[model samples]
Target: MNKSTFNTASAIALAAAALAGPAVAQQATAVEEVIVTAQRSSQNLQQVPLAVTGYSGAFLERSKIEDFNDLRTRTPSLTFEQFAPGQPRYTIRGIGGGGGVAVFVDDVYMGQPSMSSVEFVDLERVEVLRGPQGTLFGRNATGGAIAFFTEKPGSDYRVKAKATVGNYDLKSVSALISGPVSDVLSAKISVIAREHSGYAFNETTGRDIEDETLAAARAALRFRPNDDWDIQLNIDGSTRRGTAPWWDLMIEAPKSAGKSNPEPRRGRNHTDDGYADIDNAGVSLNANWDSPIGTFTSITAFRNTQSHNRANTTGLLVAPLSDVANRRVNFHTLFIQQADQKAEQFSQELRLAADLGDRFKWIGGLYYYQDDGVANRLTDYRFYGFGPTPVDGRYAYASTNETKAFAAFMSGTFALTEQLKLQAGIRWSHDEKDHTTVASGKNFSGFRDGGVSVPGYSAASSADWSAWTPTASINYQVTPDVFVYGTISRGFKSGGFSDGDSEKQSILRPFNPEFVWNYETGARTEWFDRRLRVNATAFYMDYTDLQVSVFTQLAPNLPAVLVSGNAGKAKIKGFELEWNAVPIEGLNLYGNYTRTESEISALISGANNLAGKKIPRAPENKFFMGASLARDFGGMTATGRVDYTYQSDYFSSINNVPSERVLAQENWDAGLTMGPAGGAWSVEVWGKNLANELHVVSISDILGDAFANYAPPRTYGVTLSYRH
Candidate 1:
């Protein structure tokens, strides 16, 4: 259905329920309480004014959610796409990019989107907050924020282990141990190892197009000298090596473009070498102190990460790029590329929370972060009869980025009456970034004329920016079981230098910050003796100075470069609904839906007139529903669950090219578990993508060729778990 229809349906459903609440009310078992920290404080989900979706560690395991990609179907208004392993793109209400969302592990921020896509093992809970969160989450949170809380050391000793064997030769083992070391100390450790021979079969190479090997470990130590203070230290590391799926040339090139139209095939590749490797490690320290006036918290962290990727640049083209005439060189021939990147980051945060009597509560914090990174790329066309010299089709590019940031934030809530409350928060942040780049190449690719006269070029640039965002919210309890709230908040995303182009495009300097003002209203209700819970939220956002990449050629007779700038304006609106019911004992049902509409109102002068184009990756309609049944059989217990998800079509690029869109698709997954009552072990059998549907999750159009990545096929697995 269209956006209007979807939105109307949502409104009618919510309004009807509110009007007929008493008629539908009945006696039943109450649902469990859901607690969240989306507001920087622990509160019942129903009492919070924000839109958040939370999944507990137990829920995650039962749902077979191994990573963020698998978590998408269980949540509303969330989607993921990728060009390669570890290079993930997430969209929320059509407002996502490099500077849209922020990810946090415990209190430590992961600076890059790719870094946040790691496996979600050993997590206590995962929370997703929708809308701009700049007032409290600092920079780069225009769309929203995702927070992952890891399991902490416990007061008692415990041991847990799990193993799984799945289709495509997939095998994994994970273990966790926790124990008390002394009177005042406790420690916990978790480790996981997994390997998968991917499902993508290559037609030309006779090999699997994608495969993975992964290992991760985390250890935590906690010290509690007394009731007034505590400290925790965490160390985590992970390594991944994989052969990423090869791209499919979907839409054929036009004959008028002087290129042959090759048929598209799934999991087929002509490239001989394509692989990715990544390593990440981090350390975090947290301390908490309680005083008569307030509670103080400090979080300090440092991280190191590195990655390498190798691929064929021309593998998707039908014919080699060359000239059979004058130079006897084919520019369309094989072009292999390699990229390497390494980064280091450090962050510190201090926060104080105070409870002034029972009517007033406040929180304030200060944060600082630093990042340094370098990336280098090399492209070679020697196999296409070209030498290693720049004039002979060899190219190299290198870039470095250094960033420093600081912020201060404060928030307070006041109970004006027994049923009404007022909340206000504001944050001020400053950011500085330095960028340097060097490029060396002959310029033999594609141009009406010979490449530039220079064999090498270099450029350096820097930028400093600051922003102040404020939030105001009002909430009122209509009844003991229902509440209504409204909020107006501003969010900001810090801009940085572009990395898509070489020094030849010096005009692609530093970009400016992007900002959004969000206005939202919502209602949370628990009816039928608390057996049914429903929450609905509607939001309107005004976005300005949006950072967008424009393809352009800085000089005549040269190829185009992707230069980013704050050059767009847009309007975004959406509605979300979440509902759960436990109408009968031993049975539970839960579902969520979202309707979103986004329009690009303006763009830069030289860019295409995309004023009416739909935002990329934002589907007009998304829905999910699931049911679980549990029962006792003598001395044993059995549980079964099934879920279905549906999403509308969406474009992958801001250009709104027809070839870069993914069609609507639906997916199904189910699981069954069995274990003896009071036993320490259980077994689960699960299947995902049961329908074996083939769909594209991402697509791109480059040089008149349409390339895309497909979602995984059907897979089934069995897992065994034991805990003590």
Candidate 2:
């Protein structure tokens, strides 16, 4: 993105959040403990022992989170980077997949980033599980896992709704309904719609807009014939439509200029006018049975998504750039292009455990999963102000890949003694990837000069691989509130064909899957009779054959896209602290902080001097703090909370480009919430980026020059939600 667009990233956010409303719908709290079975078992987040984070439906209405990116403010070690235009690659603990993060609903694995859908209304909670989850999850997830739990059928009839309007002509409305159908069955469903007139304008086709409209619904069916068997079925679906283009930088402006760039001739166009439309659907069944020996449970799921769009790659070429010191037009450049992608997949899980008396217990199961799809990219190019020339011309290129994968696994927990538990697991995965590329009628002039492109270009390649992973963990209860645990695990990612210099090695050389050997120990405890809760962990990940994306000026008209294969090692160690304090009744304080040291340990011997270099994009320090006060009146209950998140400086590029960095930035988001003292109805006026702090979330090639993706600026909105 260009500095022009990044400078205004906050304005775009303010305009967007106003129109987007909150992440989900609002309703009365249903479950007291907020149950989540993401690990294939029902467990409270506080009791799970593993590093976990969760947000309930109530939290959404109170905080006013409209998009997944808003989550970055609340969770530690969680990050998101845009993949193409609308899709986002979410990561946890600095361990996200190279291109995207694997997601699951209920128990079904989701593969398509473009069409994936998440709605907050009727949702149970959003769960983020840190570390490699190799033992139970279908595919070998090296980084971590995320799950969205929807509300299921219950015993009572309920109705909920929320409406909001604010900056940039934004409007949002949502509703949900649930009740008992018969003595043995019950159901619940939710619907939401959102709209905004955009905060950006296009220079070519002037329009003040970047609008999004999404409709989502989820239903749960519950049945019970007797006390012995309980079964529930769930279905979810949604479609999102808007002009969410890949807004690249058309101009690099100073931080002072903000989204208010001083450019007028671009015509009927705004930097964010890239257009797209999307749709998605998912279904699953969860059943539980109780017997004398123990309890057995099963979770099955499937999801499908289809997304399409025609994004104007024009921003890449027309972006205006200047030196860091002066806002002078540095160059007049232009290129036009776009890509189309689609993906879909399914998964299932079964868990059975037998309680062998009070002291002995164990559980194990078989897991299987398979995915087949194609990611096809079509690239088209053209020049500005004039027709095609000898040096500049219009062209199209096409590429496709078939991804198929399968895996099976088992794990169990054994009690060694009264206060200690032993956990072990193993898994084997087989993955096949087929890739092909074709470039025709495209003249390559710069390819002859740049060392990165192939001399006499041809378009395709393919490959495949199999992998195995093992893990062990031990938990010792030092006391009632303190526990010490350590785990060592391994995970791998499949290797595929690369179009660029990724082929530096011999063609006969096999593509080695990226591996992560992580070691860690942690503690979870509370002191002063639950007045303070502290969860801390220290971890190190040894990365090998790390898949790295390489960019080069292979084709001036193409903006160079390719990958490179190399063996490199790195160590990422970090400490995280989350705590709560209650010094007095009706008064509470909370704080969370993370400190990490991520660096390059080796860089292919003599190829690069990256050893000891700090990893790009990884911030060294991040902390969030908040305070809440509540006093019970005779007939009503009311409370107010305010929070702020602070992060240190971070690099934007792998090479540690200085000009492209998100410097020490501080963001403060606070909310004033008050309900009918009884907690049945409430209204909240919230301000995010309350200080109007201008900060960048990410920066990439937008036309060129420091293109940045920024956070939303200061804005205040009001929300009124009700439940009965």
For this target, which candidate reaches the highest lDDT against the unseen true structure? 1
| lDDT (Cα, tens digit) per residue for candidate 2, span 1-724 | 1223322322332332232222322222221234566446676555554666677765655556566766766777776666343466666666554532467665666766664456666665777777677666636466777777666667876676776666755565566667789988888766666655554456545665355665566778889767877898888777766664434453453432223235321233234355566677878888878877667777776766666665544344345445577644433334334455555555656667776766555566655454544444433443332223423544333445566666666666677887798877777777777655544444433332234554333444556677778888888888887877888887776665553231223222335677788788888777777677777888888888765553444444434443455448877889778777776676667778888778777764233465776666578898888776665567455567788888788766555545556688787777666665545566767777778775665665522445544444566677676666
Per-residue lDDT tens digits for candidate 1, residues 1-724, read 1334323323432232222111111122566677778887788888998888888887788678888668877787888777676667777788777858788999789986546855666788888889999887876889988889988887877666777789988877777777789989999877777778766666556777667777777889999999998899999987777775666656654621223225333433555647878889999999999988899999999999888888654444433445655554343334466888898999999999999989999999999999998989777653322243323376777889999999999999999999999999999999999888777765444321123446666767888999999999999999989999999999988888876454445423677799999999999999998889999999999999887765565544323445677657899898999998998876779889999999989875354677888778899999999988777788777889998999999888777877668889899999998887656667999999999886776776654456666788888999887766
Q: TM-score for each prediction?
A: 0.89, 0.84
Q: Clash pairs of candidate 1?
A: 320-332, 321-330, 321-331, 321-332, 321-333, 322-329, 322-330, 322-331, 322-332, 323-329
User: Per-residue error at 14 for model 2, in Å?
Assistant: 25
Question: What's the residue-level lDDT of 210 in candidate 1?
Answer: 66
lDDT of 2: 0.61
Q: What TM value does model 2 have?
A: 0.84
